[model samples]
Target: MNFDYKLFEMINQFAGQNQILDQTVMLFSKFGPILFGLVFVWLWFSKSGKKVDNRKIVLYAITITVFALGVNKVIELMYFRPRPFVTYAVNLLSDKTSTDPSFPSNHSAGAFAMAWALFWHRKRIGSVLLIMAFFMALSRIYIGVHYPFDVTAGAIIALIVTAVLISQRRLLDPLYQNILQAFRKSKGQKYYRNM
Candidate 1:
Protein backbone atom coordinates (compact mmCIF):
# COMPACT_ATOMS: atom_id res chain seq x y z
CA MET A 1 0.00 0.00 0.00
CA ASN A 2 2.66 2.49 1.05
CA PHE A 3 6.35 2.73 0.21
CA ASP A 4 9.10 2.35 2.81
CA TYR A 5 11.34 5.24 1.96
CA LYS A 6 14.14 4.43 4.39
CA LEU A 7 14.59 0.92 3.12
CA PHE A 8 14.21 2.11 -0.46
CA GLU A 9 16.90 4.75 0.04
CA MET A 10 19.25 2.20 1.57
CA ILE A 11 18.87 -0.22 -1.31
CA ASN A 12 19.13 2.62 -3.82
CA GLN A 13 22.33 3.83 -2.27
CA PHE A 14 23.82 0.36 -2.29
CA ALA A 15 22.86 -0.10 -5.91
CA GLY A 16 24.09 3.31 -7.04
CA GLN A 17 27.79 2.91 -6.36
CA ASN A 18 29.42 0.63 -8.90
CA GLN A 19 28.81 0.97 -12.63
CA ILE A 20 29.68 -2.66 -13.37
CA LEU A 21 27.53 -4.00 -10.58
CA ASP A 22 24.68 -1.78 -11.68
CA GLN A 23 24.98 -3.08 -15.22
CA THR A 24 25.12 -6.62 -13.91
CA VAL A 25 21.98 -5.99 -11.93
CA MET A 26 20.26 -4.46 -14.92
CA LEU A 27 21.25 -7.37 -17.16
CA PHE A 28 19.99 -9.97 -14.75
CA SER A 29 16.90 -7.92 -14.03
CA LYS A 30 16.09 -8.01 -17.72
CA PHE A 31 17.14 -11.51 -18.82
CA GLY A 32 17.87 -13.66 -15.78
CA PRO A 33 14.57 -15.51 -15.98
CA ILE A 34 14.99 -16.42 -19.61
CA LEU A 35 18.64 -17.33 -19.16
CA PHE A 36 17.93 -19.55 -16.18
CA GLY A 37 15.08 -21.25 -17.99
CA LEU A 38 17.29 -21.90 -20.98
CA VAL A 39 19.99 -23.31 -18.73
CA PHE A 40 17.45 -25.65 -17.14
CA VAL A 41 16.24 -26.83 -20.53
CA TRP A 42 19.73 -27.36 -21.82
CA LEU A 43 20.87 -29.19 -18.73
CA TRP A 44 17.92 -31.52 -19.04
CA PHE A 45 17.87 -32.06 -22.79
CA SER A 46 21.28 -31.54 -24.21
CA LYS A 47 22.90 -34.69 -25.65
CA SER A 48 26.13 -33.29 -26.85
CA GLY A 49 28.83 -34.93 -24.73
CA LYS A 50 28.51 -35.33 -21.01
CA LYS A 51 26.57 -38.14 -19.41
CA VAL A 52 24.27 -36.10 -17.21
CA ASP A 53 21.86 -38.00 -15.07
CA ASN A 54 18.63 -37.43 -16.95
CA ARG A 55 16.44 -38.47 -14.05
CA LYS A 56 17.84 -35.83 -11.71
CA ILE A 57 17.79 -33.16 -14.39
CA VAL A 58 14.16 -33.79 -15.31
CA LEU A 59 13.11 -33.90 -11.68
CA TYR A 60 14.87 -30.62 -10.96
CA ALA A 61 13.35 -28.92 -13.98
CA ILE A 62 9.88 -30.19 -13.21
CA THR A 63 10.12 -29.19 -9.57
CA ILE A 64 11.42 -25.71 -10.32
CA THR A 65 8.99 -24.99 -13.14
CA VAL A 66 5.92 -26.28 -11.36
CA PHE A 67 6.68 -24.60 -8.06
CA ALA A 68 7.71 -21.28 -9.58
CA LEU A 69 4.56 -21.05 -11.67
CA GLY A 70 2.24 -22.11 -8.88
CA VAL A 71 3.73 -19.76 -6.29
CA ASN A 72 3.93 -16.80 -8.64
CA LYS A 73 0.33 -17.13 -9.78
CA VAL A 74 -1.02 -17.61 -6.30
CA ILE A 75 0.88 -14.69 -4.82
CA GLU A 76 0.09 -12.36 -7.71
CA LEU A 77 -3.60 -13.19 -7.43
CA MET A 78 -3.69 -12.93 -3.68
CA TYR A 79 -1.52 -9.90 -3.00
CA PHE A 80 -1.62 -7.75 -6.16
CA ARG A 81 1.18 -5.63 -4.74
CA PRO A 82 2.54 -2.80 -6.82
CA ARG A 83 6.15 -2.60 -7.97
CA PRO A 84 8.44 -0.42 -5.88
CA PHE A 85 9.11 1.84 -8.79
CA VAL A 86 5.40 2.27 -9.24
CA THR A 87 4.75 3.05 -5.57
CA TYR A 88 7.89 4.86 -4.41
CA ALA A 89 9.88 8.02 -5.17
CA VAL A 90 13.02 6.17 -6.20
CA ASN A 91 15.37 6.49 -9.12
CA LEU A 92 14.70 3.35 -11.15
CA LEU A 93 18.04 2.62 -12.77
CA SER A 94 16.91 -0.30 -14.88
CA ASP A 95 14.43 -0.55 -17.69
CA LYS A 96 10.79 -0.56 -16.63
CA THR A 97 9.98 -4.01 -17.91
CA SER A 98 7.30 -6.34 -16.53
CA THR A 99 3.74 -5.44 -15.60
CA ASP A 100 3.26 -8.10 -12.98
CA PRO A 101 2.45 -7.35 -9.34
CA SER A 102 5.56 -7.02 -7.20
CA PHE A 103 4.99 -8.81 -3.89
CA PRO A 104 6.78 -12.17 -3.91
CA SER A 105 8.89 -11.49 -6.95
CA ASN A 106 8.45 -14.01 -9.75
CA HIS A 107 12.11 -13.68 -10.65
CA SER A 108 13.29 -14.51 -7.15
CA ALA A 109 10.84 -17.38 -6.90
CA GLY A 110 12.04 -18.84 -10.17
CA ALA A 111 15.67 -18.32 -9.27
CA PHE A 112 15.34 -19.98 -5.89
CA ALA A 113 13.22 -22.78 -7.29
CA MET A 114 15.90 -23.58 -9.79
CA ALA A 115 18.64 -23.14 -7.23
CA TRP A 116 17.08 -25.52 -4.72
CA ALA A 117 16.20 -28.03 -7.40
CA LEU A 118 19.80 -28.12 -8.53
CA PHE A 119 20.97 -28.32 -4.92
CA TRP A 120 19.16 -31.64 -4.68
CA HIS A 121 21.38 -33.04 -7.40
CA ARG A 122 24.81 -31.42 -7.14
CA LYS A 123 26.00 -29.59 -4.08
CA ARG A 124 28.62 -27.45 -5.82
CA ILE A 125 26.43 -26.44 -8.71
CA GLY A 126 23.57 -25.83 -6.32
CA SER A 127 25.75 -23.55 -4.21
CA VAL A 128 26.55 -21.47 -7.26
CA LEU A 129 22.90 -21.39 -8.22
CA LEU A 130 21.88 -20.32 -4.73
CA ILE A 131 24.39 -17.50 -4.85
CA MET A 132 23.07 -16.47 -8.23
CA ALA A 133 19.53 -16.56 -6.92
CA PHE A 134 20.54 -14.30 -4.05
CA PHE A 135 22.00 -11.77 -6.44
CA MET A 136 18.92 -12.01 -8.65
CA ALA A 137 16.72 -11.29 -5.66
CA LEU A 138 18.90 -8.36 -4.65
CA SER A 139 18.81 -7.09 -8.21
CA ARG A 140 15.02 -6.93 -8.09
CA ILE A 141 15.32 -4.60 -5.09
CA TYR A 142 18.35 -2.79 -6.43
CA ILE A 143 16.55 -1.91 -9.64
CA GLY A 144 13.45 -0.69 -7.80
CA VAL A 145 11.20 -3.47 -9.01
CA HIS A 146 10.53 -5.24 -5.72
CA TYR A 147 10.92 -4.79 -1.96
CA PRO A 148 13.02 -6.89 0.41
CA PHE A 149 9.93 -8.57 1.74
CA ASP A 150 8.87 -9.54 -1.74
CA VAL A 151 12.16 -11.25 -2.46
CA THR A 152 12.16 -12.84 0.96
CA ALA A 153 8.68 -14.27 0.41
CA GLY A 154 9.68 -15.58 -2.97
CA ALA A 155 12.71 -17.36 -1.50
CA ILE A 156 10.61 -18.88 1.25
CA ILE A 157 8.03 -20.09 -1.24
CA ALA A 158 10.74 -21.64 -3.36
CA LEU A 159 12.20 -23.45 -0.35
CA ILE A 160 8.80 -24.87 0.57
CA VAL A 161 8.13 -26.07 -2.96
CA THR A 162 11.56 -27.61 -3.24
CA ALA A 163 11.13 -29.47 0.04
CA VAL A 164 7.82 -30.92 -1.07
CA LEU A 165 9.25 -31.99 -4.40
CA ILE A 166 12.29 -33.57 -2.86
CA SER A 167 10.20 -35.45 -0.33
CA GLN A 168 8.09 -36.87 -3.14
CA ARG A 169 11.08 -37.73 -5.27
CA ARG A 170 10.59 -41.44 -4.70
CA LEU A 171 7.10 -41.34 -6.11
CA LEU A 172 7.95 -38.93 -8.93
CA ASP A 173 11.31 -40.35 -10.00
CA PRO A 174 9.89 -43.08 -12.20
CA LEU A 175 7.65 -40.82 -14.20
CA TYR A 176 10.37 -38.20 -14.52
CA GLN A 177 12.83 -40.79 -15.73
CA ASN A 178 10.37 -42.03 -18.29
CA ILE A 179 9.86 -38.52 -19.57
CA LEU A 180 13.59 -38.02 -19.82
CA GLN A 181 13.97 -41.26 -21.71
CA ALA A 182 11.27 -40.19 -24.12
CA PHE A 183 13.02 -36.87 -24.60
CA ARG A 184 16.35 -38.56 -25.28
CA LYS A 185 14.71 -40.97 -27.68
CA SER A 186 13.01 -38.14 -29.51
CA LYS A 187 16.31 -36.42 -29.96
CA GLY A 188 17.95 -39.66 -31.13
CA GLN A 189 20.61 -39.02 -28.54
CA LYS A 190 22.36 -41.48 -26.30
CA TYR A 191 24.10 -39.03 -24.06
CA TYR A 192 22.31 -40.16 -20.96
CA ARG A 193 21.72 -43.81 -21.77
CA ASN A 194 24.57 -44.92 -19.55
CA MET A 195 23.39 -42.77 -16.71
Candidate 2:
Protein backbone atom coordinates (compact mmCIF):
# COMPACT_ATOMS: atom_id res chain seq x y z
CA MET A 1 0.00 0.00 0.00
CA ASN A 2 1.85 3.01 -1.25
CA PHE A 3 -0.18 5.64 0.60
CA ASP A 4 1.78 8.53 -0.77
CA TYR A 5 1.14 7.52 -4.36
CA LYS A 6 -2.41 6.50 -3.61
CA LEU A 7 -3.22 9.84 -1.95
CA PHE A 8 -1.52 11.69 -4.76
CA GLU A 9 -3.53 9.82 -7.35
CA MET A 10 -6.72 10.49 -5.47
CA ILE A 11 -6.12 14.23 -5.49
CA ASN A 12 -4.74 14.31 -9.04
CA GLN A 13 -7.58 12.33 -10.47
CA PHE A 14 -9.58 15.56 -10.51
CA ALA A 15 -7.01 17.36 -12.59
CA GLY A 16 -8.30 18.15 -16.09
CA GLN A 17 -11.69 16.77 -15.17
CA ASN A 18 -13.21 20.25 -15.21
CA GLN A 19 -11.99 23.47 -16.66
CA ILE A 20 -13.17 25.87 -13.97
CA LEU A 21 -11.98 23.80 -11.06
CA ASP A 22 -8.63 23.26 -12.73
CA GLN A 23 -8.14 26.98 -13.25
CA THR A 24 -9.11 27.77 -9.65
CA VAL A 25 -6.68 25.24 -8.26
CA MET A 26 -4.01 26.44 -10.64
CA LEU A 27 -4.41 29.98 -9.29
CA PHE A 28 -3.68 28.75 -5.79
CA SER A 29 -0.83 26.60 -7.03
CA LYS A 30 0.84 29.41 -8.95
CA PHE A 31 -0.20 32.74 -7.42
CA GLY A 32 -0.80 32.03 -3.76
CA PRO A 33 2.68 33.13 -2.77
CA ILE A 34 2.41 36.40 -4.66
CA LEU A 35 -0.94 37.06 -3.04
CA PHE A 36 0.60 36.36 0.35
CA GLY A 37 3.51 38.61 -0.54
CA LEU A 38 1.06 41.38 -1.25
CA VAL A 39 -0.47 40.80 2.15
CA PHE A 40 2.93 41.10 3.79
CA VAL A 41 3.62 44.35 1.97
CA TRP A 42 0.28 45.73 3.05
CA LEU A 43 0.80 44.62 6.62
CA TRP A 44 4.26 46.15 6.72
CA PHE A 45 3.09 49.73 6.44
CA SER A 46 -0.38 49.40 7.85
CA LYS A 47 -1.19 50.92 11.20
CA SER A 48 -2.91 47.78 12.37
CA GLY A 49 0.18 46.34 14.04
CA LYS A 50 0.45 49.15 16.58
CA LYS A 51 1.17 46.74 19.40
CA VAL A 52 3.73 44.72 17.43
CA ASP A 53 6.80 45.48 15.35
CA ASN A 54 5.12 45.13 11.98
CA ARG A 55 8.26 45.64 9.94
CA LYS A 56 10.18 42.98 11.80
CA ILE A 57 7.36 40.48 11.41
CA VAL A 58 7.20 41.01 7.68
CA LEU A 59 10.97 40.94 7.37
CA TYR A 60 11.16 37.67 9.27
CA ALA A 61 8.44 36.20 7.06
CA ILE A 62 10.34 37.19 3.93
CA THR A 63 13.59 35.80 5.34
CA ILE A 64 11.97 32.50 6.29
CA THR A 65 10.54 32.03 2.81
CA VAL A 66 13.89 32.73 1.21
CA PHE A 67 15.73 30.35 3.55
CA ALA A 68 13.09 27.65 3.00
CA LEU A 69 13.60 27.91 -0.75
CA GLY A 70 17.34 27.53 -0.29
CA VAL A 71 16.80 24.47 1.88
CA ASN A 72 14.52 22.97 -0.76
CA LYS A 73 17.13 23.50 -3.44
CA VAL A 74 19.90 21.98 -1.33
CA ILE A 75 17.81 18.92 -0.53
CA GLU A 76 16.91 18.51 -4.19
CA LEU A 77 20.58 18.51 -5.12
CA MET A 78 21.41 15.89 -2.49
CA TYR A 79 18.47 13.50 -3.12
CA PHE A 80 16.26 13.45 -6.17
CA ARG A 81 12.66 12.45 -6.52
CA PRO A 82 11.04 12.73 -9.92
CA ARG A 83 7.78 14.61 -10.21
CA PRO A 84 4.55 12.69 -10.50
CA PHE A 85 4.22 13.58 -14.17
CA VAL A 86 7.64 12.13 -14.89
CA THR A 87 7.03 8.78 -13.20
CA TYR A 88 3.36 8.22 -14.00
CA ALA A 89 0.64 9.14 -16.41
CA VAL A 90 -0.84 12.36 -15.10
CA ASN A 91 -3.19 15.12 -16.17
CA LEU A 92 -0.53 17.74 -15.86
CA LEU A 93 -1.81 21.33 -16.01
CA SER A 94 1.22 22.97 -17.58
CA ASP A 95 3.43 21.96 -20.47
CA LYS A 96 6.08 24.25 -18.98
CA THR A 97 6.39 22.18 -15.83
CA SER A 98 9.68 22.04 -13.96
CA THR A 99 11.98 19.04 -14.44
CA ASP A 100 13.66 19.57 -11.09
CA PRO A 101 13.52 17.04 -8.29
CA SER A 102 10.13 17.16 -6.52
CA PHE A 103 10.54 15.59 -3.10
CA PRO A 104 9.71 18.95 -1.50
CA SER A 105 7.74 21.59 -3.41
CA ASN A 106 9.32 25.04 -3.48
CA HIS A 107 5.97 26.75 -3.79
CA SER A 108 4.59 24.92 -0.79
CA ALA A 109 7.66 25.62 1.27
CA GLY A 110 7.63 29.34 0.50
CA ALA A 111 3.90 29.72 1.01
CA PHE A 112 3.84 27.86 4.32
CA ALA A 113 6.94 29.63 5.61
CA MET A 114 5.47 33.05 4.98
CA ALA A 115 2.08 32.06 6.31
CA TRP A 116 3.36 30.48 9.51
CA ALA A 117 5.64 33.41 10.27
CA LEU A 118 2.71 35.80 9.99
CA PHE A 119 0.54 33.52 12.10
CA TRP A 120 2.94 33.65 15.03
CA HIS A 121 2.63 37.43 15.20
CA ARG A 122 -1.08 37.82 14.55
CA LYS A 123 -3.18 34.83 15.44
CA ARG A 124 -6.37 35.91 13.63
CA ILE A 125 -4.65 36.84 10.38
CA GLY A 126 -2.31 33.88 10.64
CA SER A 127 -5.22 31.44 10.92
CA VAL A 128 -6.62 32.56 7.59
CA LEU A 129 -3.23 32.52 5.93
CA LEU A 130 -2.52 29.03 7.22
CA ILE A 131 -5.76 27.73 5.71
CA MET A 132 -4.78 29.27 2.40
CA ALA A 133 -1.36 27.72 2.80
CA PHE A 134 -2.90 24.29 3.21
CA PHE A 135 -4.96 24.80 0.09
CA MET A 136 -1.90 25.87 -1.85
CA ALA A 137 -0.13 22.66 -0.82
CA LEU A 138 -3.16 20.63 -1.88
CA SER A 139 -3.24 22.55 -5.14
CA ARG A 140 0.23 21.23 -5.96
CA ILE A 141 -1.04 17.67 -5.59
CA TYR A 142 -4.32 18.42 -7.36
CA ILE A 143 -2.49 19.89 -10.33
CA GLY A 144 -0.58 16.63 -10.84
CA VAL A 145 2.89 18.13 -10.62
CA HIS A 146 3.81 16.88 -7.13
CA TYR A 147 3.15 13.80 -5.03
CA PRO A 148 1.33 14.16 -1.71
CA PHE A 149 4.49 13.49 0.26
CA ASP A 150 6.40 16.13 -1.64
CA VAL A 151 4.16 18.95 -0.47
CA THR A 152 4.01 17.38 2.96
CA ALA A 153 7.77 17.47 3.21
CA GLY A 154 7.85 21.06 1.98
CA ALA A 155 5.34 22.06 4.64
CA ILE A 156 7.35 20.30 7.33
CA ILE A 157 10.46 22.17 6.24
CA ALA A 158 8.51 25.41 6.43
CA LEU A 159 7.29 24.65 9.95
CA ILE A 160 10.77 23.88 11.22
CA VAL A 161 12.31 26.95 9.63
CA THR A 162 9.57 29.28 10.85
CA ALA A 163 9.82 27.85 14.37
CA VAL A 164 13.57 28.27 14.57
CA LEU A 165 13.52 31.81 13.22
CA ILE A 166 10.67 32.93 15.44
CA SER A 167 12.25 31.37 18.51
CA GLN A 168 15.56 33.16 17.87
CA ARG A 169 13.98 36.59 17.53
CA ARG A 170 16.18 38.02 20.25
CA LEU A 171 19.33 37.29 18.24
CA LEU A 172 17.90 38.65 14.98
CA ASP A 173 16.34 41.77 16.52
CA PRO A 174 19.58 43.65 17.16
CA LEU A 175 20.85 43.04 13.63
CA TYR A 176 17.68 44.39 12.05
CA GLN A 177 17.62 47.33 14.45
CA ASN A 178 21.18 48.16 13.49
CA ILE A 179 20.26 48.05 9.83
CA LEU A 180 17.40 50.43 10.50
CA GLN A 181 19.71 52.75 12.41
CA ALA A 182 22.15 52.80 9.51
CA PHE A 183 19.31 53.51 7.10
CA ARG A 184 18.11 56.41 9.25
CA LYS A 185 21.62 57.82 9.39
CA SER A 186 22.06 57.57 5.62
CA LYS A 187 18.68 59.22 5.11
CA GLY A 188 19.59 61.97 7.59
CA GLN A 189 16.67 61.42 9.94
CA LYS A 190 16.89 64.11 12.65
CA TYR A 191 16.35 61.56 15.42
CA TYR A 192 19.14 59.23 14.23
CA ARG A 193 21.77 60.70 16.56
CA ASN A 194 19.57 60.42 19.66
CA MET A 195 19.77 56.61 19.45
Candidate 3:
Protein backbone atom coordinates (compact mmCIF):
# COMPACT_ATOMS: atom_id res chain seq x y z
CA MET A 1 0.00 0.00 0.00
CA ASN A 2 1.24 3.44 -0.93
CA PHE A 3 1.43 6.01 1.84
CA ASP A 4 0.05 9.50 1.22
CA TYR A 5 2.56 11.72 2.95
CA LYS A 6 0.78 14.91 2.02
CA LEU A 7 -2.56 13.70 3.40
CA PHE A 8 -0.84 12.39 6.50
CA GLU A 9 0.91 15.69 7.07
CA MET A 10 -2.33 17.61 6.73
CA ILE A 11 -4.12 15.33 9.18
CA ASN A 12 -1.23 15.51 11.62
CA GLN A 13 -1.33 19.32 11.48
CA PHE A 14 -5.07 19.27 12.21
CA ALA A 15 -4.57 16.86 15.10
CA GLY A 16 -1.84 19.04 16.52
CA GLN A 17 -4.08 22.08 16.81
CA ASN A 18 -7.26 20.24 17.88
CA GLN A 19 -6.60 18.55 21.22
CA ILE A 20 -10.33 18.20 21.82
CA LEU A 21 -10.72 16.39 18.53
CA ASP A 22 -8.06 13.89 19.54
CA GLN A 23 -9.71 13.31 22.90
CA THR A 24 -13.12 12.96 21.28
CA VAL A 25 -11.68 10.46 18.83
CA MET A 26 -10.24 8.34 21.62
CA LEU A 27 -13.40 8.62 23.71
CA PHE A 28 -15.63 7.47 20.88
CA SER A 29 -13.22 4.73 19.84
CA LYS A 30 -13.22 3.35 23.37
CA PHE A 31 -16.78 3.90 24.61
CA GLY A 32 -19.06 4.55 21.67
CA PRO A 33 -19.97 0.93 21.09
CA ILE A 34 -20.55 0.35 24.79
CA LEU A 35 -22.77 3.42 24.98
CA PHE A 36 -24.81 2.26 22.01
CA GLY A 37 -25.23 -1.22 23.49
CA LEU A 38 -26.32 0.23 26.81
CA VAL A 39 -28.94 2.36 25.10
CA PHE A 40 -30.24 -0.70 23.28
CA VAL A 41 -30.47 -2.65 26.52
CA TRP A 42 -32.15 0.22 28.32
CA LEU A 43 -34.72 0.59 25.58
CA TRP A 44 -35.35 -3.14 25.64
CA PHE A 45 -36.08 -3.23 29.39
CA SER A 46 -38.01 -0.03 29.91
CA LYS A 47 -41.69 -0.69 30.53
CA SER A 48 -42.92 2.44 28.91
CA GLY A 49 -46.56 3.02 27.88
CA LYS A 50 -45.65 2.65 24.23
CA LYS A 51 -45.54 -0.75 22.58
CA VAL A 52 -41.81 -1.26 22.44
CA ASP A 53 -41.12 -4.82 21.34
CA ASN A 54 -38.19 -6.09 23.37
CA ARG A 55 -37.95 -9.17 21.16
CA LYS A 56 -37.28 -7.15 18.02
CA ILE A 57 -34.59 -5.16 19.77
CA VAL A 58 -32.91 -8.28 21.11
CA LEU A 59 -33.04 -9.95 17.73
CA TYR A 60 -31.56 -6.91 16.04
CA ALA A 61 -28.75 -6.64 18.57
CA ILE A 62 -27.85 -10.31 18.42
CA THR A 63 -27.91 -10.48 14.65
CA ILE A 64 -25.83 -7.36 14.24
CA THR A 65 -23.25 -8.48 16.81
CA VAL A 66 -22.84 -11.88 15.20
CA PHE A 67 -22.59 -10.48 11.71
CA ALA A 68 -20.07 -7.82 12.69
CA LEU A 69 -17.86 -10.42 14.33
CA GLY A 70 -17.98 -12.63 11.26
CA VAL A 71 -17.09 -9.77 8.93
CA ASN A 72 -14.22 -8.59 11.15
CA LYS A 73 -12.79 -12.09 11.43
CA VAL A 74 -12.89 -12.68 7.71
CA ILE A 75 -11.19 -9.39 6.83
CA GLU A 76 -8.52 -9.73 9.52
CA LEU A 77 -7.65 -13.25 8.49
CA MET A 78 -7.67 -12.58 4.75
CA TYR A 79 -6.06 -9.14 4.54
CA PHE A 80 -3.54 -9.23 7.40
CA ARG A 81 -2.63 -5.62 6.75
CA PRO A 82 -0.44 -3.79 9.25
CA ARG A 83 -1.49 -0.52 10.84
CA PRO A 84 0.13 2.75 9.69
CA PHE A 85 1.92 3.19 13.01
CA VAL A 86 3.23 -0.33 12.67
CA THR A 87 4.52 0.30 9.14
CA TYR A 88 6.26 3.66 9.57
CA ALA A 89 8.13 5.75 12.13
CA VAL A 90 6.13 8.86 12.90
CA ASN A 91 5.06 10.89 15.90
CA LEU A 92 1.28 11.14 15.81
CA LEU A 93 -0.66 13.86 17.58
CA SER A 94 -3.04 11.22 18.93
CA ASP A 95 -1.96 8.28 21.06
CA LYS A 96 -0.70 5.58 18.70
CA THR A 97 -0.72 2.39 20.70
CA SER A 98 -2.99 -0.20 19.10
CA THR A 99 -2.23 -3.88 18.51
CA ASP A 100 -5.33 -4.79 16.59
CA PRO A 101 -5.06 -5.76 12.94
CA SER A 102 -5.45 -2.74 10.63
CA PHE A 103 -7.69 -3.92 7.81
CA PRO A 104 -11.44 -3.48 8.17
CA SER A 105 -11.47 -1.70 11.53
CA ASN A 106 -13.52 -3.37 14.28
CA HIS A 107 -14.54 0.02 15.68
CA SER A 108 -16.11 0.98 12.38
CA ALA A 109 -17.91 -2.34 12.12
CA GLY A 110 -19.26 -2.15 15.66
CA ALA A 111 -20.35 1.45 15.31
CA PHE A 112 -22.15 0.77 12.05
CA ALA A 113 -23.74 -2.38 13.39
CA MET A 114 -25.21 -0.59 16.40
CA ALA A 115 -26.24 2.42 14.35
CA TRP A 116 -27.98 0.32 11.69
CA ALA A 117 -29.63 -1.93 14.26
CA LEU A 118 -31.02 1.04 16.13
CA PHE A 119 -32.06 2.80 12.93
CA TRP A 120 -35.05 0.51 12.50
CA HIS A 121 -36.27 1.33 15.98
CA ARG A 122 -35.44 5.03 16.31
CA LYS A 123 -34.76 6.90 13.10
CA ARG A 124 -33.59 10.16 14.68
CA ILE A 125 -31.20 8.56 17.15
CA GLY A 126 -29.97 6.10 14.55
CA SER A 127 -29.25 8.93 12.11
CA VAL A 128 -27.10 10.63 14.74
CA LEU A 129 -25.32 7.40 15.50
CA LEU A 130 -24.63 6.86 11.80
CA ILE A 131 -23.01 10.29 11.61
CA MET A 132 -20.94 9.51 14.69
CA ALA A 133 -19.80 6.23 13.14
CA PHE A 134 -18.71 8.04 9.96
CA PHE A 135 -16.61 10.48 11.97
CA MET A 136 -15.12 7.67 14.02
CA ALA A 137 -14.01 5.97 10.82
CA LEU A 138 -12.51 9.24 9.61
CA SER A 139 -10.68 9.66 12.92
CA ARG A 140 -9.16 6.23 12.53
CA ILE A 141 -7.71 7.34 9.19
CA TYR A 142 -6.68 10.74 10.55
CA ILE A 143 -4.83 9.17 13.47
CA GLY A 144 -2.97 6.80 11.13
CA VAL A 145 -4.52 3.81 12.81
CA HIS A 146 -6.33 2.63 9.69
CA TYR A 147 -6.04 3.02 5.94
CA PRO A 148 -8.88 4.50 3.93
CA PHE A 149 -9.41 1.08 2.35
CA ASP A 150 -9.88 -0.47 5.77
CA VAL A 151 -12.64 1.95 6.65
CA THR A 152 -14.24 1.45 3.24
CA ALA A 153 -14.21 -2.32 3.60
CA GLY A 154 -15.64 -2.05 7.10
CA ALA A 155 -18.48 0.14 5.91
CA ILE A 156 -19.31 -2.33 3.18
CA ILE A 157 -19.32 -5.22 5.61
CA ALA A 158 -21.58 -3.28 7.93
CA LEU A 159 -23.98 -2.58 5.09
CA ILE A 160 -24.13 -6.26 4.15
CA VAL A 161 -24.80 -7.31 7.73
CA THR A 162 -27.50 -4.71 8.14
CA ALA A 163 -29.16 -5.80 4.89
CA VAL A 164 -29.15 -9.47 5.83
CA LEU A 165 -30.51 -8.83 9.29
CA ILE A 166 -33.32 -6.70 7.91
CA SER A 167 -34.19 -9.31 5.30
CA GLN A 168 -34.34 -12.10 7.90
CA ARG A 169 -36.28 -10.11 10.45
CA ARG A 170 -39.56 -11.77 9.61
CA LEU A 171 -38.32 -15.30 10.30
CA LEU A 172 -36.53 -14.29 13.48
CA ASP A 173 -39.26 -12.09 14.86
CA PRO A 174 -41.40 -14.92 16.28
CA LEU A 175 -38.46 -16.59 18.04
CA TYR A 176 -37.39 -13.25 19.49
CA GLN A 177 -40.91 -12.54 20.75
CA ASN A 178 -41.09 -15.97 22.37
CA ILE A 179 -37.83 -15.45 24.18
CA LEU A 180 -38.95 -12.10 25.53
CA GLN A 181 -42.23 -13.63 26.65
CA ALA A 182 -40.36 -16.37 28.48
CA PHE A 183 -38.16 -13.84 30.23
CA ARG A 184 -41.13 -11.74 31.26
CA LYS A 185 -42.95 -14.79 32.59
CA SER A 186 -39.94 -15.93 34.62
CA LYS A 187 -39.56 -12.49 36.16
CA GLY A 188 -43.32 -12.18 36.76
CA GLN A 189 -43.20 -8.79 35.12
CA LYS A 190 -46.56 -7.04 34.75
CA TYR A 191 -45.56 -5.78 31.31
CA TYR A 192 -46.14 -9.19 29.76
CA ARG A 193 -49.64 -9.59 31.19
CA ASN A 194 -51.28 -7.95 28.20
CA MET A 195 -49.33 -10.14 25.78
**C-alpha lDDT of all candidate models, in order:** 0.76, 0.84, 0.72
| TM-score ranking from best candidate downward | 2, 3, 1
Model 1 spans with C-alpha error above 4 angstroms:
1-5, 16-18, 45-55, 97-99, 188-194
Please provide TM-scores, in order, for all candidate models, with all chains considered together. 0.83, 0.91, 0.83
Q: Which pairs in model 3 have colliding backbones? A: none
Rank by lDDT, highest first. Answer: 2, 1, 3
Residues 1-195, candidate 2, lDDT per residue (tens digit)?
289999998888888989999998887777788899998889866877342377778778988998899999999999999888888998899655788898899888988998899898889999899999999999988888888888888899999999988889899887766766676578787433222
Clashing pairs in 1: none
Q: Which stretches of candidate 2 lie over 4 Å from their true place?
A: 184-195
User: For this target, which candidate reaches the highest lDDT against the unseen true structure?
Assistant: 2
Q: Candidate 1 or 2, higher TM-score? A: 2
Residue pairs that clash (backbone atoms under 3 angstroms), model 2: none
